[model samples]
Target: MNVRTHILRRNNTGGIFHQRGVAALLLVLLVGISATVVTLGTMSYVRGSQKSQLTVHGQTQAEINAWSGAEALGQYLNGIEVETVTTAMDDIVFSRDNQTIASAQYKPDCSQTSRDLYCFDVNGISAGHNSNLEVVYQIPIIRDVSYTEISNPIVIKGDTEVTGGGMAYLSSDSIDGFAVDGNLTITNATKSIASGCATGNIHVNGGGVEDNGHLYSSNGDITLEGLNLVGADIWGGNINVLAGSGFHFKSIKAVKNLKVTNAGNFKSDFIHANAVSFALEGQLGETLVHSDIAFGNGKSHLDYLEAGGNLIFHQDDQSHVPEFTRNSKIAGKILLRTGEDGNTLSTHYNSTFKNIEQGRTATDPGVPEWPECNVDATPFDVNTLISQANYIFYIDESDKPMLKIQNVKRASDDKSIDATINLSSEGGMNTAYLHNKPFFQCEWDSKSCITSKSNSTDGWVFEGVTHFPPGVILFAGKGNPNQRNLAPMNFTLASKSEKVGPLLNTILVTGDITLGRGGGRKEIHAPYFSSPDAVCDGDFYPANLCDKSSGSWQFEGKWDGDRVERNYPVANTSIMVNHTMTSEGWSLEGSVIVGDTFKTDSNLTNVHGVVVIGLNSDEGGMKITQGGIVVDFMDLDSNFLNIPTGNTQVTDESTLGIPTAMWARYY
Candidate 1:
């Protein structure tokens, strides 16, 4: 019985041990499984974090690339010529690591906001990331003049003196300032003057100065008396404002003394001078006076004042009476220093001062520099135009004195042709006639015309037989007499057309161009002699018939003679003369460029276009005698002629693609 019981106990113990071992094994397997799951989860998390970081880097890179492309395009536009900027605004690609990373293109129709503004759009790509950027910039107007360094585009090499009630009206655009190398004095009562820049003194007595532009004097004084000076900045050596003048200026800077007396209704933004003496009634802005200040009897309003010397308030006779009632007010600070004899700031009755500061060292206000004049003798070469000409005619001693052009074939292949020909003259009656057909028989002395083909052979003819091709006409006189050729002959163009048509012709003469002097009245209607359509007409030269009753030749009761007219709206007519261009009782339309003098005498003359005088000599300028001359530039277009590449003057306001505004987005 004991042996059987012991065997049962052994079997039970073995079974319990087997069960414990199996349980331990199962616990080990569970621990292993949990560790494996944790490892896999950690790996997955790491991978995901790396991917997110790479995406962010790519997005940032794309944005940077887009910004860089925009900048690059701006730089390119800044370096290239302004005329080519529009063409360069096409699609432009940027590459990195031998791959195209970004592209830039111009945004069209954006100029409607402002003609000076330009817009650009850019796109960048990096590692499947895209970015877009838009940039905007502003540009300024570009002006082309004869000299790049000259501040004034219209230059008279010598003095311009108009005296004795002569009516001389000079005007120009703001960009094209007028200049005289020598003195400029206008003593007429009916003068309407614009802005002027001079190397010498500028004196004006009795006239109206327009609010056109600024006046700059390099080394001389500027004096104004008995006139109305309006809205102009005067910078010069000295400025003198006398009695009976109405003054309104933005700023006045004088190197020497600035004297003002009886300046009625005076106003200025800023005034700087070495010595200032004012006895005026007006408002003044910031003023910097280097020397002593003499403020006389006047009611003045001042903004800021800085005086290097003694500031005194006295009467017109320089007597400092305490009872002198001078009401003056200051809005800002007053800076002053003690002058001779320990004399400092002095105030009159009813005078007000603000933030007065004394016992300070005075500062020197430097002088303003003068503008340079570097004009070229010839801005363009006449010989260079030869290759571009379609018809070349050389008139020398062999050609007839009276050359007639009739029934010539018009060039139909091209829009325009350039004619380089010479017109001959002899016996003081030498005339050149360019006519299309027989249209009118006009009497010069009577200023009357009869539209009859029977009498057309005797007088100027204007039948519609043919038309002169539209082109640039050049008239070159014989070479210089002292050199080898004969004396320069005057270019006289007499045109008789039945019907005046749309004319597009630029006439360039090497010598003199005379009108309204001979027995017959001269007329020029170009692009052709005459046409039946009658598209153009002038003062004396009518479109269909030369009827004096219908057209009044008298202009301002002064001019009554021949007429050179281009009725076309476009600026297709121009006249350039190397020497004198004289017009008597004549009216013209187009640009006039004279190398020497432009003269008008005993008649009224009206000109529409740019007038550039004194291109060859410093002795002669403009001479107008007993007549009125009016030149209006606003009637002509700016692109009438091509500006030379070397003579272009760009203003400070123009900058190439400055990138004023920018916007960016990423996808």
Candidate 2:
């Protein structure tokens, strides 16, 4: 009976259980779906984070690569030859992987003004896993280019037109071989081709009319309109420029005539010529015309005519030769070859004939013989030669004879005699440099010598030579000046101090010549000399004057010359020796004494600008001749003068408002 009732209930129970099972299955499915969703979300987040990290790393690497590329470019730029453009890649490198990151556009046109000199700009596109990067590199443009690398032979040729702006650098050790095949038109106002050579030539092409420095020629020629030449050896083969132009050269050796048809400015020495036969129509400043400069007038304007050598007088168009009849200060001999015409001396200006063969001074009115002066004459003592010295001159007589003199006095303080010299046919030497020996033998002439002490019994005193006034002398010969053996104007001996240079050859004195000095001061003896007629034969060698000699005289006075050499053997140069005074703050004229204060006047005013040079002076005080002319101003020694307060007292008490533990106290 129970089994039958249970069967009925089982059917009902099974229905209910099946329903519950279905609900449970639905719940299980829902939970599984939620779990899967969470897992997918987490996986997506991890993958995104991983991609982002890779992207950041790649970007950083790209930036680093870009910086490296920039450095590499800089190195390449640095390695480029100073005057020559890089033909091929010297050492241009790029990272292989980062190469696609950027690209650069080079501007080969020198006339174009492009902002390609800056850094490379990077444009990044995608920031995710698969990112695309773009890098833009800039090309370098040179401005105010400097040559800092080793140089090579660089020839800038052709009708290479620089229309806009371009710059070229030829640094030391670098030579620029500029060849203008065609008309090289450089219209760029700012364009410059600065050539700096260590030991090479900048052979420019002929017919290359430039608007600036060194216009045209295989050999250097000043054909430019407005160019400043700073070359050591300026061989003006054919220098043709506009009138009233500026031609500034350091050392000019012109083989041909320098004709300034219009007004021109020549501010340098014109040397090494048998005769300067040219029609000068310009303003000449410090015109040092060497040899017999045959000058004629053809609408020519001469500023200053300085004859350092013998001057020849000849008519340009069969006219009477104009001669200088006044007190002409001629350095060398004078020859007037009228050329079968009448000899008439005329002076455009008041010129002085120092060593005159036949000059107009009322006494010597006509021309003298070949040996007008003495030759093979007796050697005069230094003291005798210095006194009554009206003029000093040297003549060339040696036939290929090199005049060589040793142990001779080049300068002297006492002036008791005058000197005249003529070179001998066998060739003579007149060297003023004293090696280990004295410059001259100083024998006190009883009557001429001054006593050093107050007692009349004191022996005759040998006055040490003082400073010599600055003056330029020119020497001339009947024939070729270069062919004749001539001596340098001045020479000096080596000094004892290491700071002093070797025996000085040339010294430019910028002061006045005085006899005596102040009280208690010995004659500032610095031996020097002058010989007018020491020979009358052939020729001799003349050493360079004003060269930097070891034991040379100190240039304490203001120096003014056409040019000033500041290096050994005249390597470096300065245009002028800057000096100043009260009225002449920075004048080209003025007598400057050595060891002078070069300060302000007693009126509390600044004096002239004087340059003081010393070989060795531990005390920093120079001994000046007592009565020597010196220019000083109040402000000159202001830097060294210290005004002490009268109330100030020295104390060493630690607590008494004074510094204690002071060492190295003298008193």
Q: TM-scores for all candidates?
A: 0.52, 0.21
Q: Write the per-residue lDDT of candidate 1 for residues 85-195, one digit (tens) a residue.
A: 555557888776676767887776655223456667778667888787665554322222232133333556567665533433344444444667777776764664556
Scored by lDDT, the top model is 1
Segments in model 2 whose C-alpha atoms lie over 4 Å from true places: 1-154, 157-193, 196-222, 226-233, 269-278, 281-292, 296-667
lDDT of 1 at 547: 17
| Model 2 C-alpha lDDT per residue in residues 412-444, reported as the tens digit of each score | 311111112322323232222123322222122
TM-score of 1: 0.52
Q: What is the C-alpha RMSD of each candidate to the true structure, in Å?
A: 31.6, 37.6
Question: What is the Å distance of residue 185 in model 2 from its true position?
Answer: 8.0
Task: Tell me how far candidate 1 lies from the true structure as C-alpha RMSD in angstroms.
Answer: 31.6
Best by TM-score: 1
Steric overlap count per candidate: 7, 99
TM-score of 2: 0.21
lDDT of 2 at 426: 33
